[model samples]
Target: MTRPSNDSLNAAWDLIDHSQLILVVMHTNPDGDALGSGIALTLGLRQQGKEAHLVCPQPTPLIYEFLNPGDIVEPEAPAGVPDLAVVVDCDRADRVGALQGLVNQARRVLVVDHHPPTSDFGDVRLSHDGYAATAEVVHYLLAHRSVPVTGRMAEALMTGLITDTGGFRFSNTRPETLEMAASLARAGASVADISRRVYDSRTLAGLKLLARALASLQSSPAGTVAWARLSADDFAETGAAPEDTEGFVNVVHSLRGADVAALLREEQPGVVRISLRSRGAAVVSQAAEALGGGGHALAAACVLEASLDDAEERLLQELRKWTAF
Candidate 1:
């Protein structure tokens, strides 16, 4: 993994130190990485006596209720404009959703992300795709600036590392990743507790949603591609929120002969959300970008303005262009 340059790290520190009220923003529909990194940074800044706030465009998912760092409010135009806005775990400005306008109002923007940037917007961009999670990058940044990593910060950072690596099972798991996990563990992060809460804990509604998604699973003729669809009715019948679909795509991605997996869900009446996953060889981000979405190479997502069936067909065609099957 490429290391963050000292120049960028120093610049980020200068920006943070000079700023009194800092606003930390994460992407909409935040996953573990986005929430973890954002919360960790906010807490760290507050510990340093800075007025830092973490804001999201959507509510935090129930699954992450355990790592509550307090006061993660929904995005709004602040009463006093912040000196610096730090956007975390988002590849593009649009990913910030409604928060983009508020972020733009800041005097300066600093983007802290692990995904490759889709556009240039931030005044100080500290992004490197080599890191497995944005939390890892944030950890490095804090360490470089000599900020103490508190137990709570360690737990939040560990959550990002564990969730993004799929419990250290994904190909992104490197020696440095494990070493960082070990450091967080030494700093009071509980691996067993985190894994249990994140991966094992699921509500009945979530299980029902997963069952429905698996029941609708299909595959290509050559068995190289596996796909599934869940309509809005499935969400209504199961009483599951959109966040309940988290990690559901992994089920199809684990198929024996499947090199690529796609999950199409009707997030709203006329809006379909498509998630794509691969076994590392296939660059699924290309397909996601083609559909006006963006993410990592192995895991990506896109939302389409079409019915579930139409979105599935369109995604399958895009997947075919990238995968052999």
Candidate 2:
């Protein structure tokens, strides 16, 4: 979809105004960008005299505990249907989990996301691969409509911007992204606090989980493609949650000669989840799409029909083709 314009911004605002209760949902196993953008948008909508609440499938990362002061509700919902629902950072309705029913049952829907989507599930869609984060798109949208940004809102937006852009290390980070970060910082976002909370608060289980992933790492074809497979038993042994496995693929991508990385996680007995990362001269999303998934050029993911070992081998074969070395 196209980037939302000023006129489109007004249309979104108009939609918000007419809707009585706006239900906001984000992707499952949400990262900082997903949680931050959804929460910030919820806060922004409430400040604008609208009734807004956040619902997600899984609990947010423990690092984000500093953001809010309550339990993440896994609501036994379907309380009628919402007047309007906004999906942020979710590419597909299935990513919304139990709320998928609510999205289907809602009267109107809008999807505002940064990822290249696999599904066109929104009545009004605003998707831009150019933006570094969905927080960036939503920030500009709110700023265009003269929506006031509180101190808390600034903090949330900054968290999304920093985390998704790899603290500005990722290739997607642009000059405008930095400028937006500066603006958010100036508007009362604390870089030190966000950094400390997100990066420095690793749990003991997370550390052990990282150790297991590192131990399982493998390289192929002169180390152009690196990979690791994590099983449910590994998580049980390490006492780590699923979110702890996040970014383990990046460890492989960081290898000196490795241009691409894959993490094949056995989420269930027969279900394998594939997460792909690429640095340069490789298009990970293409491989993901070939497996019925989609995301950005640098990072993408897919669910494999095969078992763990088979999925890992299949992904390794695909990654081998992308490597020049």
* Candidate 2 residue pairs in backbone clash: none
Per-candidate TM equals: 0.96, 0.91
Q: What does candidate 1's lDDT look like per residue over 156-205, in tens digits?
A: 99999999999999988878889989999999999899999898988899
Best by TM-score: 1
Per-residue error (Å), model 1, residue 190: 0.8
Q: lDDT (0-100) at residue 195 of candidate 1?
A: 92
Top lDDT: which candidate number?
Answer: 1
Residue range 37-60, candidate 2, lDDT tens digits: 887888888878877878775656
Model 1: residues with Cα > 4 Å off, grouped in runs: 69-77
